[model samples]
Target: MSQPDQAPDQAPDQAFDVIISGGGLVGLTLALALDQGGLKIAVIDRLAAEAVLEESFDGRAAAIGFAAYRMMETLGIAQHLGEVQPIEHILVSDGRIGTPGRQGGPSALTLHFDHRETGSGTEPLGWMIENRRNRLALDIQVATRPGITRFTQDEILDIQVEPGAVRAKLKSGTKITAPLLVGAEGRGSFVRKKAGIRTYGWGYDQTAIVTTVAMEQPHGGVAHEYFLPTGPFAILPLTGNRANIVWSEKTSRAKALLSLSPAALEAELARRFGDFLGKVTLDAPVWSWPLSLELAATWAKPRITLAGDAAHGIHPIAGQGLNLGLKDVAALAETLVEAKALGQDLGDLTVLERYAQWRRTDTMTLAISCDAFVRLFSNDIGPIRALRTLGLGLVDALGPARRFFASHAGGDVGDLPRLLRGESLSPALN
Candidate 1:
């Protein structure tokens, strides 16, 4: 088990190199990354430090893209998260839930992405690991690193960013100073909000109901994404004969579904699940998230910068939210480490803008793509449905295109950071 969160042996008045406002996955990873690169960090969050070290399961699991998985491995956290289920094959199809295929058989406009074709050298498309497992693993990892302090149950009331310093006033009446401030807080980031960074996003009329399901048959390491008029229904593989269900429906219908008796919910699951898994039963309580796409207007200003959900939040249709956050961790870590090597101030607007520039285009591209997918797939229009059915067939037939998309979905497409590439952190310093 990891030790409780505490500061280093330095003077109580000493300033830190960086202070992160949210100590969830991204914040913790950043602290680990920067401290490895020789920077002191302070992390503050509302979660109790003791509880964070336990084997807590949050009911939601994340799809770790292959690149992000490599980054985790490089950070020495991957090996500790036990029993990750790899996605060997992904099958996508368009079908109405209660509607059958043509000729009263089964719809066959299936699109597939095979992991073997990704040129990733035996790596699967990605791995599905529970959020709790990742959090637990990181909790242990952070306790062993020096100069990385975690202050749980602490809230920052306000932030003042000066030319080369950031002073954060906590509700507990503590004033912590650091050269740079980073917000890994969620979409409703208080720090980002205080910094006057506007956000633009819209809610889908849909909600996603998530839970684990046990079945009579093994999953065989395959993932399924079935597009319904309501939204995409994702069945991700887990160890043994279990899978995670991310089922989407209209907000009202979802609320009704969640409010039903256990038997009623089981019948509802059977209506969409078919006989593929065989004898499915709910293994846990159903959890839900209202679908939305939220993007920060600006990622950085002067001594402060935003990462993870603070910067952008998107639809989970592609399961890239956490992976994207990890990308931000890698990118910000690389940027700040290199900047320090050049004798640059980590909080300078010029330095911060470089990080923002490197990330803005990619984040927007993902946001737009998620919006397009939700719009195209979540509609009941007859013509659009027919076109999508045809598109699925066409995409399946195009081998090279399918392979490229698979790799892209696996987080192998654009400019990758050193961490994602499985390289050492700050090679010169090492």
Candidate 2:
């Protein structure tokens, strides 16, 4: 078995085939995947593993697509996801400005994506899971992998890629070397900076205010997206009658709105969200995050590679941020495993390039699509609004077009990795 690569001044430990930085969901999940692939791995993070595992399930939730759910299952983390709320259907509509259809005379056009009708049989397309639970599940899985060593409260200070190995130095005075280094450190990844890899993307002049609310009426397992003038207000179903809300608005407006008194904030929320959920009361602390779309100039350079938020960070308008990262983990792990099976070096440029090629097109497409959606639909103007509303109506009226859109939301688009296809990783031969 491989061992951890120690610093020059420290005692030698087991060197790892892969060294992963960051212990977030994406990072830990990738560590588990690599371990399952028979590669001894070490994962380092700035936060304690217990802290991640013991986090409370609150308003912060993720809309997990079917494919993502399947991957979690294969990783042995899905069963630990607490209180899952299946998304039985999704209702997409525009606010006030109605789309053309039916006898309602240009009322909001509702496009329902029912999983049962889409050849998914009795299974729902996806489920809503609290982010805390997702992180906890990953922590648990990583802890059980014998091939993986996890270090928390340790931050990476720098990375040095040599001819045949990559070295990682930690702020805690620890060091490790591996054939491959995976940067899953998040948007402001230090590994990316240490590698001198430039990034390309811009920030949307918006902030998403997230919180949960107790609604009087049941959501009936249906997620709702209301395209408002400022941005899309997503009401994702949570356990019971509670729904997680991600309301995007102009940064200036968000700042002012966040400063409003509790009573005033409730009033504003009710007005924007309408009476669909009846009386709504905030059930969690409001958290706001600036929206941005960031992509690395390159996913890999020699023995160092980027994954998840380290590679790409996009606006959460489509709720596909985590899913995209999970996709990266699956693809990268599979690429390395396949390379090993062919007696090729896992860190070879050819092998790593395949992984980068697999993700680039899809990543770029989603980034551009999300940016365009945010730009076009977030504005309230005479001609643009009318045109977009009409476009929504036209798309809703077309069945094939609607199915195509639904498939993407369901994570059924494009080539899927073996892990996403529900293939189990083989036991470590070593």
Which numbered prediction scores highest in lDDT against the true structure?
A: 1
Q: Which ten residues in a row have the lowest lDDT in candidate 1?
A: 100-109
Model 1, span 126-237: residue lDDT tens: 9998887888888888988877988889888888877679988776666789879999988889989999999998999899999888988888988888888889888888
lDDT of 2 by residue, 1-430 (tens): 9988665557653478888888888888898787778788888889876665543433478888887778888878987776799988887766543323321111355666777533365668688988887887787677677888887899887777788888777777777888888889999998888889999988888999998889898889988887777888888889988889999998999999999988899887887666667888988888889999899999998888899999999988888898889889989998987787777877778788999999999889888899998888887787987788788888777878877777676666789887887786664532
Q: Against the true structure, what is each candidate's TM-score?
A: 0.93, 0.92
Q: How does model 1 fare in lDDT? A: 0.84
The clash tally of candidate 1 reads 0
Backbone clash count for every predicted candidate, in the order shown: 0, 5
lDDT per prediction? Answer: 0.84, 0.81
The per-residue C-alpha lDDT of model 2 at residue 95 equals 58
